[model samples]
Target: MESPSDAPASAPSGTTPGLMGPATILPRCATGIEGLDNILEGGIPRGNMVLVAGSVGTGKTTLSLEFLVRGAERGERSLFISVTEASSKLIQNLSTFEFFRRDLIEQGSLVFVDLPVIYDRLGLGEEELTGEEIDILIRTIRDLVRSLGAQRLVLDSLTSVCYRIRKDEQIRDFMLRLGQELNELGCTSLLVSEIGPNPARYSLHGVEEAIVDGVILLWNTRRFGDILRVVQIVKMRGTSHSRAQYVLELTPIGILMAPHLKGGREGGP
Candidate 1:
């Protein structure tokens, strides 16, 4: 069994003999999303906690859902923990995507869980979660992941959960413990962060972005009188990646990306 750690296994030593280079290449969890994998130079390092931050309608949820679907198709158990939306409604919306396969859910490879159910079961009904309550929450999440043998997970709208925690210290501690648990379980996770059109920080508490291993920021920009969706890799640890902004498209088949033409002004959703 993997030991609990705050981050993924450290990169190989520079002096290590290898045909690829000085160090052996790190293992990646391919997202299977068109341009995203390219931007990530294959995909995110396994066991990373990436923040998918964006305003409303920028496709944060769509991108995350696709990640889970692709993982499940690859025989990896995937889980979706919905905080702000109903799983049934999410399934309804997912049906429109051509790449989505309902059979994955039926086969038990993909699972959809509502956060409220966990909260109720744990008796975490207060507006603010106490320190002990937060510990319970983290333990429950870890237990669920372990029970499902999940290799990939998504927490839709992490901002909603942070709102209840309120204090920055607690929020930071929560993320740290939760991330460690997931990393130890070998689960690559995406925590959706809902922000405004132009935000100073990617997360609600401004501390979450610092705790995660990566940040993928999405937004809408106006170019030639048309609003185009844009994606940029603000930060990714444990591996090198392209930080350039790209144009993103949401279609029935799935998301597509192209290099941004530039000269576009930022716009609100």
Candidate 2:
């Protein structure tokens, strides 16, 4: 791993060394993923809205699931709002992971809800949501988080949700209010962003990334005749973390990461 000095030299005073090697000023909501937490300094600062941006097959959903599962293991109530897949199918896929505990769902520590179901119930049937409808959507999410007392939340793909929110201004306002609602409830959130490879921006609407508290970017690249998944912290609000890129692996146990060293066999799987 790279040294902590590789982080920003302007890190604020009174920030303490975190679980890994970096420093943070606020309480952390640890993802508990090997190497990732290390890169995050410890974990995401509590109540932060982090954008997990990546192209397809870049392990975005897997990483988000692992984040929720790990949080649930620590006795934190976790919620997953799936936009593309059914909750049952997600749980079925999650069962293959060694670290996954099905009982966590049965025990109600981890909960999954389909965003489509919520939309249907809320009567947000239009392709483009009105500003008033956007408020309803945000309130619905806030209510779910509050009712579940979810300490950690994951939205499978923010792109899917934003597709219905066409205007950049509306998307920005929605994110701002939703983030404020979650932060007020003490919930740390991961909002997945599906983008084309090498996107100019991390989200469907460029403004989505700006409203977020942090951005963890993932993408695929060719290296030594092999395709590799790479991850990096593009931005994080309250922590001094490594901006270095790392190789990401999606394993049966869970997500793993290692520093992306050029021509080094040690990091890549």
- State residue 219's C-alpha deviation in candidate 1, in Å: 0.5
Which pairs clash in the backbone of model 1?
A: none
Model 1 alpha-carbon drift over 4 Å, by segment: 1-22, 263-269
lDDT of 1: 0.86
Displacement of residue 54 (Cα, Å) in model 2 is 0.3
Give each model's whole-structure lDDT.
0.86, 0.85
Best by lDDT: 1
Per-residue lDDT of 154-260 in model 1, one digit per residue for the tens?
99979999989988999999999999999999899999999999899999989999999999999988766888899999998866778888889998888999988
What RMSD value applies to candidate 2? 6.0
lDDT, candidate 2, equals 0.85
Error of 1 at 101 (Å): 0.7
* Each model's Cα RMSD: 4.7, 6.0
